[model samples]
Target chain A: MAVSRGFVGRRPTDSARVPPGQYVTRDFPVLSAGPTPYTPLDTWDFTVRGLVNRPVSWSWQAFRALPHENITVDIHCVTKWTKLDTTWSGVSLDTLLDAAPTQASHALAFCDGGYTTNVPLADLRGGKAWVVDEYDGQPLDPEHGGPARLLVPHLYFWKSAKWIRGLELRQADQPGFWEMFGYHNYGDPWKEQRYQGD
Target chain B: MVSKTVETPRVTTIAVAIQDWPGHRAGQHVDVRLTAPDGYQTERSYSIGSAPEDAYVSLTVERLDDGEVSPYLVDELRPGDEIELRGPVGGYFAWDNELGGPLFLVAGGSGLVPFRSMLRHHRASGSRVPVRLLCSARSLELLIYREELIKLAADDLVDVSVTLTREAPDDWRGYRGRIDPALLAGCRHGCFGA
Candidate 1:
């Protein structure tokens, strides 16, 4: 590693809290691969399918009627920004998976804008992930993934697919959109897995 | 490092020569990693501003006031300074002449970096693709690649429109205010589906 001649970083106080090669950012930067998609609430729905005992889906009204939890978690983007204690309200993936009854060990989250991210089913179970709609007690904005988005805080933010439409459980692992391009199939920010072969 | 040019007060373009660099497509980015004297390292991704046809890879960076990396990249780096970076990363957002289109490119602030690469590629490859670039900047003075973009707009197949969101010269004519649905709808005619 070539040391930059006169470079000095912020030297974040809680170094232990941050993953390797990451810095804390109070401002949530908006990064996208395409134009922001606005899905009308009247037609919005979430589904769980593929290799499940039976497919299950919830309309916007039915989804809101289900139990909700207010969670505060630290989110780390693969781009190297970490936001701490971001509060969100949503239904847990466990809640959804419980209904679907899947024996699959992998999942592919598909979104409205054709964005997809794969995660192991093991990482998403036992109250580990959610389908969040409210951020900081306010309706999530379109630019920040409104309507509903997958909230898998443990993995890189990209794995938390925005404008999330459904989770398709798979019998075997498969690469998602970014994974197929260059990103790591299982992006673990703590491992500094930003690209393929991190 | 090859050369540096001041694009705007807050933006600077750095050109670097990479060894055995596989040529990159337009709209690709590179991950720049900087290590301090103490081994405290940070990395950031920057969109390539130079076309694959260009002799050197170029990255135009905008200095964010509170940004840790941008300030160093824009203000401190110099020619001959060794910097560590990787790739030609990203494929989803890349554009090439083969992807023929009446392309509609929209950008605000430094977001125009990748489109610069695309535009340059279009010119270098002699692509006849109809291109429309809608760019927004706080002011004319703050627009990156101001002169180059104007010269590129001279092409019959390319149309460039600028919207000054903050300030404009008294006699300036182009566009003013933010890019909203109305402005997009006006630009979308005959270009999107046709």
Candidate 2:
């Protein structure tokens, strides 16, 4: 490490933004929501709390066997690059909302790492979101928040929390980690909501 | 100072000429992107700290630990290295005399990048609005642009406030604490803009 700082060795290039391509399951896996993988299915439970008529709690297998599928899309990170054409599998937020029977005006998804993000119920049911379990064709990778990460395509990537264990539907809108520290709240790419002022 | 595009790791500063190759605004940030050996892409947005009047653009790149971007920049980039970047990417934070007042610049870590642009642009434009730049760093060694900033503060072109969070030398006489409101008041109010 040179005592002097502030020089980048390489030129900035879109050369690094890999094009959309095929993916498979091994490339992805559910990771790090809770402490372990084989969480005793019978003993395992997740709750859907936060602003709803009836909070639903269910076992792991019960949620798994309900219904599942996958989708492919592009992800734009706040760090400033757009990754195109990736695949994922998981339950749709619509399905979860339907089963959970929530009339809450708003919902905040909660997961491990004390992570939470707010999304309106309309956004979940309107085809803009999902509870993605698979990525790049594999079961989700833990680092990418596998097993299940919220897939909110319309908002910035962080809004889609990874390694999610539960949902806490809130009636109000609250900011998340980066938001509390000055990063944008909604984080809409088209709107360029990357930082505070905007 | 060079006009040609160079492939550099991280651009500490860039001076753009011609105002062409897709012109730029002072407060906007460009994406200085690169690819790691493992194929994971590392990209970061650096504010265009250079004054638009200047023939070129400049950005200050402060390295971060495991910083996929900055380390390569400060250590690997050399003169005439090719740089891939796209510019002028922010709006809400930019300076607009259309919405003018005394400016209070507060930066923690790398957050100061934008303010540097705003202040430099102010100087380049020859504006008289007083500006106070408060920079916080872990210690003296980590202070970016230390000599240049001190000169700027001493010149009184800008009122600078440096808060050292840890390991101050015995000779240290400036503020040696965090960014509390009280400490902030200790600075020149006329320059800090309240």
Best by TM-score: 1
lDDT by residue (A1-198, candidate 2, tens digit) is: 112133423333343432211111212232222243333346645678866677887666776776777688767666555556678777777777776776577777777667776666777786678877677677766678756778887777778887667788766777755676556867777666777776
- Candidate 2 displacement at residue A198 in angstroms: 20
List model 2 lDDT by residue over B1-194, tens digit each: 35322222223554544336565555677766554444444457777766556566777676554555666666666655556665566553668444556777877666666676677667767767777788887777666656656656654556777788886778776667788878887865322222
Top model by lDDT, which number? 1
**Predictions' DockQ, in order:** 0.79, 0.06
Quote the positional error of residue B46 for candidate 1 in Å.
0.7
Per-model TM-score on C-alpha atoms: 0.95, 0.52
Residue A45 lDDT, candidate 1, scale 0-100? 90
Q: What TM-score would chain A of each candidate receive against the reference chain A?
A: 0.96, 0.75
Please report, as a residue range, the 10-residue window in candidate 1 chain A with the lowest summed lDDT: A8-17
